[model samples]
Target chain A: MRRADRTLGVARGLGWFSIGLGVVELLAPRALARGLGLRGQEGLIAGYGAREIATGIGILASRDPTPWIWGRVAGDALDLGTLATGLGRRRGGAGVALAAVAGVTLLDVLCARALSSRRERQPVRSFADRRGMPKTPGQMRGAASDFEVPKDFRIPEALRPWTSAA
Target chain B: MRALVWHGKQDIRCDNVPDPRIEQPRDAIIKVTSCAICGSDLHLYDNFMPGMKNGDIMGHETMGIVEEVGPDCRGLKKGDRVVIPFTIICGDCDQCKRGNFSVCERSNRNKDMADKVFGHTTAGLFGYTHLTGGYPGGQAEYLRVPFADKTHIKVPQSLTDEQVLFLSDIFPTGWQAAVQCDIQPEDTVAIWGCGPVGQMAIRSAILLGARQVIAIDCVPERLSMAAAGGATTINFETESTVERLNELTKGKGPEKCIDCVGLEAHATATLDSIYDRAKQAVMLETDRPHVLREMMYVCRPAGVLSIPGVYGGLVDKIPFGMAMNKGLTFRMGQTHVNRWSDDLLRRIEQGQIDPSFVITHRIGLEQGPEMYKTFRDKLDSCIKVVIRP
Candidate 1:
C-alpha cells in the first residue's frame, strides 16, 4: 500500500529544498561563507552542504520521515550556532544569512512536528490488506501446483515440423 | 496468435504461434495491448544471457486487457486492464511473505538449473531465459499469465497505457537502485550509462535528494536526456569519467555511484575496460564489467554503490580489495517489483514522474526483429521501445 500522499509529498519537497540550498553552498562556498559572516570557512560551508544533502536523501528514501526530519532540526541548531559565532566576526551580509537561516529553522521545526504527529495517525497495514486483492493465497491454488504439462501445448523440436518432446 | 520468437542470436521473427490458453487453475489469458523491449532483452538478443532455446517467445514488460481466466482465478475478470509484473510470485512462500518476491522459492520450475549456477534458485521471470523460467513473454497478441491474482495489477481507467506500463520493470528497478544507496542529502551520485535504467536512476536520485548527479555515457541522445533529467553529462569518448567526476566534486569524488550499464559495458582508453572487452571476446570472461570497476575506483571512502544492471554469470577482476579498503557499501539485485510497483504507480498518478519520457519508439509487434537490432545498436536514438501487439 502507498503512504499518505501529503506525508510523502512534504518529505520530497523538503528533500529537494535541501538539495537546492546545498548546490548553492557547494558551487559558491566562498560567497555563502562570506554572506553568513563565516569568511575563510569556505570548507566548512561545503561540509554543511554535504550534511544537508544527506539529510534530504535520508528523508526521501524511507517511509518514516520523523528521524530524518528531526536530524534537520539538529542541523538547524548547528547553523544557528555558527551564525551566532559569525555575529562578532568581521564580515558582510552576515545578518541577512542569519535571518534566512532562522526562517528555514522555523520550516524544519514545523515539518518535524507534522511528521511526528502523522506517524501516530497512520498505522502500517497488514500484508493481506496491502495486497488489495479480493482473495488470499489460502483461498486460491497456484496454476502449476498439481503439475502436468498441457496436452495441446507442444514443446517445439527446433526442426522441420516441430514436435513435442513430451 | 502471432508472437515474436527467438530463433537464435541476432535472429528474431514474428511467427505464427499457438494461441495461449488457460493452462492451469489460476491462470489468465491477456490480449496484450502494450509491451516493451527491455535493456535486459538485448542480452538475450546478443546471446549473452544463456539457456534460450529456439522457440522461446520473447518479451516480459506487458500490460493488457484480460480476455479469459481459469477456474481458480479470483482477483481479475474478463475486460479488466492489468499490468503484469515480469517476475511471477506465489505469495505464500517465506520469501514472498517477506516481500522478497523476486527470490521466491516456489515459482521457478527450473530451480535446479538456477541453483546449480547461483548456489540458490531465484524467482521465475517471464520471457527471461530458462534459467529463470521458460514462461513465454508478452511480446505477442496473447499471453498466459500464471498466478494471475498476485502477479498482475489492475490499472485505473484514468491513466494511459504508456504512463503505467513501466510499473512492470525498469521503474521499479531504477527506484530500487536509488533506494539501496542509502542516500543522504549531502551525497553526489554518478551513474554510468544513460540508458533507460540510467535515466530513471537520474530521476530517482533527484527525487531522493542527490546534490549533483553526474551521468556518464557515450551516446549523445542518452547523455542529453540525462542532462534534461537534471544531471551533468559526461561522454566517455570525450572525457575521463573518474577524473571528471573527481574534478566536479572537488577531489572528494561522488559519495554514491550507480552502475546502470551491466555486463556489456563499453570502454575507451581505460586499461581495465579494454582488457575486459578483449577477455570477453575470447571467452575468458563472461561479462565486460568496465563500469563496475570504475564505480569502485571513483566512489569516495565509505560511499555506497548500487547496481541495477543485469549480470548473468560470474565477473572477473572486480577489484574487491579497493571496495573493501574504501569501505564501499554494495547493493545489487533483480528488482523486487511486486514490492515497489504500487508506490511507483502512485508516484505516477500524483504526477511526480512520467515514465514514458524514456520511450523513443512505438511500433507494432511485427517490427520486433528490426527494433531488436535498432535498440541493440543504439540506432535512431533508441533508448526504449514499446510494442503494440
Candidate 2:
C-alpha cells in the first residue's frame, strides 16, 4: 500500500479506537476517575470523553482526515496534561495511565506528520489542455447552431425575451 | 464470458458467467467491444440505490457488433455495429411515441415492482437496479438486448466506440439537461459537479450558446477540464459557491442551473452536507440534496433547474417553498437516450464534440473490480473509465 493509504488505514483504526474509548469514559467516568486516582475529576473526564467522540466523528466523517488527526494529536496533549494532575495522589495507577496516554499521543503525532508530508509531496495534475474540442472554446461556441431546440423543450412563449414585457 | 458482477456493496467481481442468448423474439445479442463505467453505476457500486441483488451483472454505457439476432429484430442484423441505449424502450409504447422513451411502459419485465416503487414503471435500464428492469447490463463480453429492434442506435463504422458509446447515457443526458433549460443566447448556465456528465453538460451549454457557463466542483483536474470546455470553474472547497455564483452573475443568479451531483453529494465542506451525512448514517434519509438546495437558492426567479443527476429514494431539507415561490421549473428524470441520440451522433460525426476526452482510464474486463474502487474514490484523477471487454 502507498504510505498515505497505509497511514489513512491507521488513522481510521485510531478513530474507531477513540470512539470506543470515549464511550467507556462517558458511561463510566467515575470508575475511570477512581482508577486514575483523580476521584473528584469525573466531570472533567466526561468532558474529555465528549471531545474524543467529536474528534473521532470528525476523523471518520471528513473527506480528508488529516485535520482531524491533528485534532486528535491536540486532544492527546490535553489527555496527558489531565493525567499528569493525578500523579501526586496515586503514583502507580497514574503513572500507568500517563504511559498509555503518552503511547497513544505518539501515534497521533506520527499519523499527523505522515499525512501532512504526503499531502505536500504530491503534485496537482492539470487537465487544462484537455478541451475535448478541435477548436478553441470561443470558436466552438454555438457550433451546433444548425440543430433546433425541440418544440416540447422550448420555454413558454411568455417567458421568451421578446415576448415578455420589461 | 467474463463480466463484472455485483456480489454485494463494494463487492464487484470479474467472474466467469454463462454467455447471454436471444431469450425473446425481439432479442439480439451483441459481442460487446467497449463498455464504460458510468457515474450512475457508482450508485450501484456504493449500494446507494436499492434493488441490486447478489450476482447482478453491472454496466450501462455499452456498444458492440451484433453477433446474433432473433427473428423479430428487423433493424439489426449480424455484424451491425450498435450502441445500446441505457433505457430499454418498446418503440410502440405511448411514452416512447411521445419521445419520452425513458418512461416506456412495456420494456421493464419487473413492472409491478417498479410501479409500486416509482408510482409508474419507468423504462428498463441495463445493469441498473431491479426497480428499473433488473435486466443484465452490458459490462460483460456479450449482452442480450431485449426489444433490440428499437433499443439500439446504429453507429457508422467510421466512428470509434469511444466517440459514440456515451450516446447510451451521459452524452444524451447532458444534452437533454441543456435542452431542458431551453438555453438562450442571453442565458448564463451554471452546472454542478464536474464529473463526466457535468463535463458533457458544460460542452453542451457552450454549443447551445449560453452567454456564460460556470462549472462548480472541488476536484482540481475536473475543474481544469471544465475550464478547458469554456466554463468558469468553481472549487467549492476554496470559495463560497453561493457567493461566487452571485458575484459572477452580478447578484442576478444564473438563468439555468444543472445538478450533475446527485444522491451522494460530498459530505464534507458545508453544514447541510454534514447534516445529510448524519441523517444518512442512521437511515433517516437516503439522498443528499445539497445541490438541489443550492440550485433553488441561487437560480434566477422563473429560471430552470435541470437535473441530469440521479437521485434515489427520499431526501430531507429541500427548500420546496423557495422553489415554488420563485416559479422555478424543475426538470429531472433518467435520460431519454433515444430522444437526443441522433442529433448528438451527428454532432460527433461533424466534429462538434469528442466525448472521448472524458476518458482518463482504460482497462480490460479483468480490471473491472479494482477500477470500480479507483473510480469511486476518484483515485488517479479518474473522470471516466472505459473497459475493452
- The number of the candidate with the highest DockQ is 2
Clashes of each: 8, 0
> What is the overall TM-score of model 2 with all chains considered together?
0.95
Off by over 4 Å in 1: A1-166, B267-269
Minimum summed lDDT over a 10-residue window in model 2 chain B is located at: B273-282
Candidate 2 ranges beyond 4 A from true positions: A1-5, A37-43, A90-92, A121-123, A157-166
State which candidate has the highest lDDT: 2
- Full-model lDDT for every candidate: 0.80, 0.91
**Residue B231 displacement (Å), model 1:** 0.6
Model 1, span B73-113: residue lDDT tens? 89889999999999999888999998888898888889999
Docking class of 2: medium
For candidate 2, what is the lDDT? 0.91
Local accuracy of candidate 2 as per-residue lDDT tens digits, A21-62: 999889999989888988889999899888888778777866
* DockQ for each model: 0.01, 0.60
Worst-scoring 10-residue span by lDDT in model 1 chain A: A125-134
TM-score on alpha carbons, each prediction: 0.70, 0.95
